[model samples]
Target: MTTKNLLVELFVEELPPKALKKLGDAFAGTLADQLKALGLAGADSVVTAYASPRRLAAHVTHVWLKAADKAVQQKLMPVTVGLDASGNATPALLKKLQALGADVSNPAAAVAALKRAPDGKAEALFYDSLVTGATLDTGLQKALEEAIAKLPIPKVMSYQLETDCELPGWSSVNFVRPAHGLVALHGSTVVPVKALGLTAGNSTQGHRFEAKVAKVVIKDADSYAATLQQDGAVIASFAERRAEIARQLAAAAAQVGNGVRPIEDDALLDEVTALVERPNVLVCEFEKQFLDVPQECLILTMKANQKYFPLLDATGKLTHQFLVVSNISPSDASAVIGGNERVVRPRLADAKFFFDQDRKKTLESRVEGLGKVVYHNKLGTQGERVERVRAIARAIAQQLGGEALAKAADTAARLAKTDLLTDMVGEFPELQGIMGGYYARHDGLGDEVANAIEDHYKPRFAGDDLPRNNVGLVVALADKLETLVGMFGIGNLPTGDKDPFALRRHALGVIRMLAEKDLPLDLNALLAGAVPAFGDKINDATPALAEFIYDRLAGSLREQGYSAQEVEAVLALQPQRLGDVTKRLAAVRAFAALPEAAALAAANKRISNILKKAGDVDAHVSDVLLKEQAEKDLYAALKSVVPQANAQFEAGDYTASLQTLAALRAPVDAFFDDVMVNAEELDLRLNRQGLLKSLHDAMNRVADLSRLAA
Candidate 1:
């Protein structure tokens, strides 16, 4: 009846950001699951956890003071699953033995697998037999360790006392950090920690160098965590840390008077949390002359280089002041401010030199240098990629605009990556296409070219924005296509989280841009169109690469909740545009929500059940042999809807097309209900079969209704 909280904090050396979140989730989930198997979980109770770069902790709440009594069964549940071709329990339980992959051909071999006790008094089969008893808590702990051992922590480590237990491969258990300790607590008492050689304890430490070891005794689980904080550790709740940082940031910015703001980087905030213990925001000022540099450069220089939050005016203009977050509180505030400014100056100087040097050379002159930067080991250079981009962009642009803009788009694609050779982009690699646009415009190139140059890498991440202009969409896709095709050629495709080339993101970006940009080009044709423009040799045919593109596209769409059948339904028609495919799938998804779609799905299933026995349903329907009135009615209903469905398809009103095809469902059910398809007369039987065939084709115009969910 009584409960207590449980706390576990793993104090380790700094963990990589790459694996910190995953390790935290594993610790939380494994701990909760372990307790649940022990019959210790409370109703609706959640396991809470967090990680700093240095630590990972899990707190199990409403945990029973003692694990509840659990009935454990050692026997695996067995049931009749299938049968041998000749029906019998035969020598074996036919169904059970078939499911076990036993040789059904030799019935006696299957019979031998059945449980025959050592005493020769086998009471029952394995399915019916049961073990008398088992312990729950011990089993739970074993299962927990097995599952946690598989959780991915990319930077693996071993912690045994070969003391520096860090090895390249499996000598001991690998973890994100040294996995210094694992604290397992069950209510107020220590859970067994022999697995990780740790014990739940009352003592905790703080800020390794700054603060001394602090001791506090915990009466129960609640006090266990509360006591850790009382001993000077923040305990690092991500949600709390985020809120605290936001609140402190808002208050600090307000103190700057006219205008100030925190930078919009969740990523940097995560890193900053790892860099500090008790985060304190300190406002500092740099020389206003730094503001004379372009505002974009100043912000990047401050935020990325120094990790200093940039201060912006009310109108979003850059100000000379910045906010620095420090871990320790010191009396000499200005001295710390001077230290950050000193670190930031060289980065600011680099940006200034890049700006001055790049302005002198027109975007046109930078093309020669692109050849020196190899695009891939086999795929020539960036200069060659631009040439291929020009050809591909020209063809794609035709779908976006008239000849003039298409020509302008091709011209823009030709020069987009020229800025990669520029001094500014060389120092700031993140600003590759970005600097191209800036330089192109300042050198008097038209706006379209500049837009295309910058927009080529839009939708860089899943939640990132897509390119706004048609010119950008064309080049962006051309770039991703080259990467996808070229990588597939060189055998560097992603496998086992080894996407060093970022091909998945590139594929997703292509899919998102095409669907959201409303471009009306055939993707299959586009893939075919671009593959020849690749490296001099063709390792894979255009068709094979097109199919490859579709696989990635399907994977990308499936992640958005489209089922494999739904993707196939849309993809089968070879949709002319991604927007068209998305629209068709959306209509199917929406119609799937209606009870009528379910009704239609059920009716289609009945039709499939009756006709799927035959070779193919694409057979011709015979009008001459209709016998039953229901048969005549159904045939007429299907023929009448064909034109209506085609009209809706032409107008791209898929909802209307589905509705039009659904008109045959009533007549279809009537025929199936009243008329026997395999009648005494062979002519009528064939006629009725033909009628169902027509129904299959008509409904498929909307989507294969047979594939939709009932």
Candidate 2:
């Protein structure tokens, strides 16, 4: 078998930084899925992807070399049999075929119309689109261009020196930076094809500094990357980038001190990696006086704007030290540090001014300032949101088991967004939550209320820390509740990857807080309580918000590695409480792993089938009605086991509940073996049906055993 390699590079104008970073990963993954779905062997296809501001590429080697050969199938109707009198091809192709010196080539079309389909139809509409050849180079080049076309670049433009066309001519075009060109080489040779009028080339351009356009002839995906790296630029395979970044951070941190390290944030690290080619580490310092400004603002400025990593001191507090990685290795590292210090100095000065001014007033005194800010146009002002939050927090606190926590939560919710009005938080928007907490504490609010301000925004993104204190949970619930209810009320729901409100995140955060922390409350009623707080602002909030939260839970759980259907099944059984629902999901997952669990599922299905056959089995199997020994045995077995299953279920020992239910499997099997309950006697059949229903009720207390895949 002669195998071949194919390289596909889309050298376009410099793509947006974010788009460039995302496109490389999505491009490779989507293409691999497409190729495999086209019946190509994915394992044999080695795909190596890389991207920079200007170009995106995937090098696929030994890529199954050819597409699988298959006969194309189509359906043709019966009445169109001949061409027109002019000898032109006809709608009915027969006359054209004869004119073209052909026999009755495809009898399948006629045969299919007359017969039932074995392969849908042995027919020809316009001769079936056949696989003449796989042509890996041709297919690969086309897929790459199509993939780029499909990518959702945030800001797109067609650089046509003068002409206005979305697909710019290569002669004079520009991307965000500039579109030089793309290269697709087929095993040490330029892949010869022109699908989108782009010809494959053996050339590639490296980074702008020391790297230049060079002829790179590679034999495989691995070699292509090594060739690129040798030329310049890191070929960003996900695993490769991750490992390299980790090594750089570790090495940099070790150089500073054993106790010092980069603060944790996965997303910032990813963006930082994409923004640089070779990472050269540097540790810089800020004046300790700036630390007096809220650490929230200080750290946000460092990480968010500068991509500077803050380092921890030995005492586990934000310190004056920071570590930053620059793209280029500068001769005067001191000058680089000085330039950064220059950039942040003014920002830190502004932060200190905001902090001083904010501290002059109590958090309560600043509460009125929220009225000037807008939360969402339809949802009302920030002041209105605060009112809603306060109302919701009070109810949630009550649901969460107390008056003290409720009062603190309500106070925190009312004052949480106060920092949005603060000049310091305005300058550093990322510091909103933490700043509010800081100011509240400075203003002499109790620790519970002050802490709740910061804690409510816990787990800002997925896997972020949740609030440990009950006071925080209450306020968090209120904040999330108000957004969800208000957004859902106004019908500005997320659709087709557009979630302007991040209602989904709020729901996930709410679920994580409620379930992960095992908060004592019903989520459904809490959502209800939030609606009234929103007052006439919400219409039909109950069911809609419930469904919205459910969707959020399903997505969040699926992202955490649980199957969506599994979450749905559990939620369908009980949507009253998120904490219990999550627990139930965990229970079902654990139950699924047991050896006897599959049998129990199969047995439950069997019971369902029997019950379905003999309807209305709600009553007792009076000995008079039990005409069969099998029916009597099932009744006796269920009576003994149902009690214990209920007990375990009440105690929430779902694993034990599943085990106890499985114990009935033997009796159920034996009963099925001996029973012929569907006899001529109607009463006996009804009696057997009732017995099966009893068993179902007992087991379903833990899960819908009927839905479990045996």
Candidate 3:
């Protein structure tokens, strides 16, 4: 079979920067996958995706001009139905064979050639045939249509194209953007394919202004990127363009000297890469007075509004000069730099004005305005939510550090939501908690209270840092707890992935703080404390909420490499103090490694089943009723081992506690082997049950050993 590399490109208007990467990957992946499925491409074929601001393209290696013919076997109806008792073909069988493109004129011969096989309880007839492979022209057209249909377009645009008629009829086309050109080449030959109401060709338009020619004619499939870069003056590969932009940014920053570097943000880099075809990094500067405003404000305005990369000094402080990735590289470059600087000055000035106007009124004054701002229709105003958070925070603080911490937490919680009313935060909701801290400090509040106000929303996502101080910790916990409980109470629990309130994130934040911080607080007690703040506004959802949190913890632990059995065993106890969960899991893991672990785990499972049927057996063994010597031996062993294990457990040595019980394995085996748990005498049976119950209780202090039975 002859084969050649294939190249396909779709050129259109500028694509959404954030969605370009996904679109490119999906386009290339789906096209290659469809070709492979059709047998036109082998499994080992390589696919390369190229995307720029105005195009998505793919180059696939070893794509055959026609798929290899395949032998196919298809099952037909039962043999009895296909042929009559006398072996004459029935009309149904002839119709089926006709539908399958088999010869139907001689039905008896066709039926005679059919293979017989057992399909379930009945014998079925099978037809074997050779299927001709699809040609590249038809296959490529289908693959291109499917790939375009499957693109992860953020939005679609509809437009009309001029028809090839002298009368000037227009044909409507719906696509991510208005289709300008479509290029499809199999090696050097143009594959006749049409998409988005445009026919495939060997040529495509490149960089609007910098292209040496308006249209760069792709000579061959292998030369797509080279031709675009050399003749069209556009870097075709997204990754190559991103690397070029990074190299240019680094080189430009080095020219400024003193270890200055461009701010590192991969998302920003990707967006900039998608915005320009020929990236030319230029250093631009705004007035130093803009730096007097918070660096976060200036940096955000420059990056978000202008798509500029702010330079950073050796100490990670933002510099006045920033870098811009321009589409065209001019020899002088002064106009580009000056134009970008002029564009960003007003954006920075607006941020500064908002910050100045916000600090004029104290956070305390803003607190009153939150009453008018609706937080949730069911939860009432932000003022009401603040009061609830304050109550919860005060309770947590007092439990953690008494009156001084309580006062600080309460003050912070009261002012935490006040930033929502500030002009700066109102304009940029991402800076809500941050602006509150700044304004709190401006209001002459102490560091303890101001820091707590800001850090209340700390650890916003996975791996984020927790609060820096005890007051901040209390406030953060209280804020998260209030959201979890209130939402859960109103039957707004997260279903599937539709957690509009981010309840799962809130639960994870709670778990991370409880486990990572290892605070002396009990999770159940903390949840109980949070629930009362809602009063009659919520139901008693603490049980369900606790289960959800534990489920999240289990998933997190498993992701951290703990086995399902290990996680199940530890979480089975529903330990109120989540801080000790890791220690218990470690102990369970250690115990599972013991030589006697499998046997003990099995015996524990047996004991649990026996005790459950025995109905409320007391832990007191009543040695007077011990008839079998094995039962007496086991009771004696428990009396000796339980004390040491209890002592270790009391000392917070869970591993030692579990390890100490390994000695009981032999006695337990003997008791179970020789003794009949349900004896003829009630007293003896109860005593045996009590002995097993006592054994069960000691073995599972750290985790439910029965869960490790398998």
Number of the top-ranking candidate, with TM-score as the measure: 3
Number of the predicted model whose lDDT against the real structure is largest: 3
- Every model: Cα RMSD to truth: 8.4, 6.2, 1.4
lDDT of 3 by residue, 1-710 (tens): 78899999999899999999999999999999999999999999999999999999999999999998989999999989988888888899999999999988877688778999999979999999999999999999999999999999899888998888889789888888887899999999999999988899999997899899987999999999999999999999999999999999999999998899999999999999999999999989989988888788788878888899999999999898999999998899999888888899889889999999988888898788888989888888899999999999999888889999899888899999998888888778888788888888889997888888888898888888888888889899999999999998888898887999999999998898888888888888888888888878889799999999999999999999999999999999998788899999999999999998999999999998888887778987786788889998998999899999999998989999999999999998998899999998888887888888889999999999999988
User: How close is every model to the real structure, measured as TM-score?
Assistant: 0.77, 0.77, 0.98
Q: What is the lDDT of residue 466 in candidate 2?
A: 88
* lDDT head-to-head 1 vs 3, winner: 3
Find the 10 residues in a row with the least total lDDT in model 2: 110-119
Off by over 4 Å in 2: 1-14, 25-45, 58-148, 162-177, 181-246, 314-316, 376-378, 547-572, 575-578, 581-640, 661-696
lDDT tens readout by residue for model 2, 616-638: 67846577777666667777878
Worst 10 residues of 3 by lDDT: 614-623
Winner on TM-score between 2 and 3 is: 3
Q: How far in Å is the alpha carbon of 321 misplaced in model 2?
A: 3.3
lDDT of 1 by residue, 190-217 (tens): 6654345444454455555444354444
Q: Among all windows of ten consecutive residues in candidate 1, which has the lowest summed lDDT?
A: 73-82
Per-residue error (Å), model 2, residue 109: 21
